[model samples]
Target: MEISVFSIQKSKADNFENEIKEYIKMSSKFAKISDLTIFNEKIAKAQSAGSESALKSYDDIYEPNLKGFCIALDEKGEKLDSIQFAKILESNSQISFFIGGAYGLSQNFKQKVDKIISLSPLTMAHKIAKLVLFEQIFRALCINANHPYHK
Candidate 1:
């Protein structure tokens, strides 16, 4: 299976970047992994036009030829614990996650995704949120492998 995460954020702190890379390295053992950081500047320009417009551009790239489930980290989305998350990954051959810009994804974007998930009820910066999401994904991998890293 392949896992890809698409996100919009400014550059991360070095520590955050390093840690995320480490997690991805560890998670790569379980599946093919990739991450795309959609820079804030591009989204800013798109936001000037409107979030929906920016999201449409994203859809143009990722929406078509989708071979697996698509998920978005959304505040109003459903919640799933580590075990359930691992199950989601194991069940799919390809998965993509979208983390929108500061303003959040539009309803149109949310509706298009296969699942919308909430990491927490509280809001967070997109950069930091990416770290948290990566960690959870790593944890899920550990759980799936019956590794002690999850606990």
Candidate 2:
């Protein structure tokens, strides 16, 4: 399978980035995966304006990038167990997960995606959320392959 995680944020050199890299390395045996960080002067200006503007900006930028088996991480989305999450991976050869910016994804954007999922009910930092999503993706792959890593 091929998986891509798209996040609305500038690239960062930090511990979370290091940990995310580790998960990507570990997941290599199961599938090809990549993380794409997106942020530009336009997005920065939108963010400075307000949450609503930032969300609109996110929709504009992300809508065109939507690919096969698209999934958006949203606070109001359904919560799935690890096994359930693994099932989605087992069925889809190409998957794209979107992690919205600080203001969060727009309701219309989430509605347009194939699936909307929530990592947790509580809000988390963008980098931290990316790290968690990477770890879970690795775990889901392990579960699907009957690998010991999941246990």
Candidate 3:
């Protein structure tokens, strides 16, 4: 499987950056990572852009290359266990995840995705959201492989 993360922004904190990098490195063991595209959150929010419009702009940018299953990460989305998410990873050869900006994902984008899931019930900074998503993905891969990392 090939997993791709389309994130709104990169983490500026050094520690968070390092952790994300480590998770990315660890994830290579599970699936082929095609791309980790980070769009500038500031640019995404610029010039009177609402969440809906900004998200649509991104949809245009990444939607074409996207194939197979797609998922959106949002606060209001479903909460899945590692086992369940592992099934999703196993089923799709090309899976793409849409991570929102600081303001979060738009309603239109939420509705357009094949599935929607939430990392946590509490609101988080978008950068942290990216980290959590990456970790969960790694955990899911571990679970699928019967590896010890899931625990």
> Which has the greatest TM-score?
2
Residue 119 of model 3, lDDT score: 84
lDDT of 2 by residue, 1-151 (tens): 9999999886687738888888999999999999888899889999999998999999998999898899999878889989999999999999999999988899889988999999999988888888989999999999999999876
**The 10-residue segment with the lowest total lDDT in model 3:** 39-48
Check candidate 3 and list the clashing pairs. none
lDDT of 3: 0.75
Residue-level lDDT of model 3, residues 1-151, one tens digit each, is 7888887564455527778778878889888764365666544564147755666666665566456788988888899888888899988888999877655666766677799998889988777787788888888888888899877
TM-score of model 3 (CA atoms): 0.83
Cα displacement (Å) at residue 105, model 1: 1.0
Q: What is the lDDT of candidate 1?
A: 0.79
Once model 3 is optimally superposed onto the true structure by TM-score, how far is the C-alpha of residue 105 displaced, in angstroms?
2.1
Relative to the true structure, candidate 1 reaches a TM of 0.86
How well does each candidate superpose onto the true structure, as a TM-score? 0.86, 0.95, 0.83
Candidate 1 or 2, higher lDDT?
2
Task: Tell me which residue pairs clash in candidate 1.
Answer: none
Candidates arranged by lDDT, highest first = 2, 1, 3
**Stretches of model 1 off by over 4 angstroms after superposition:** 12-15, 40-42, 49-67
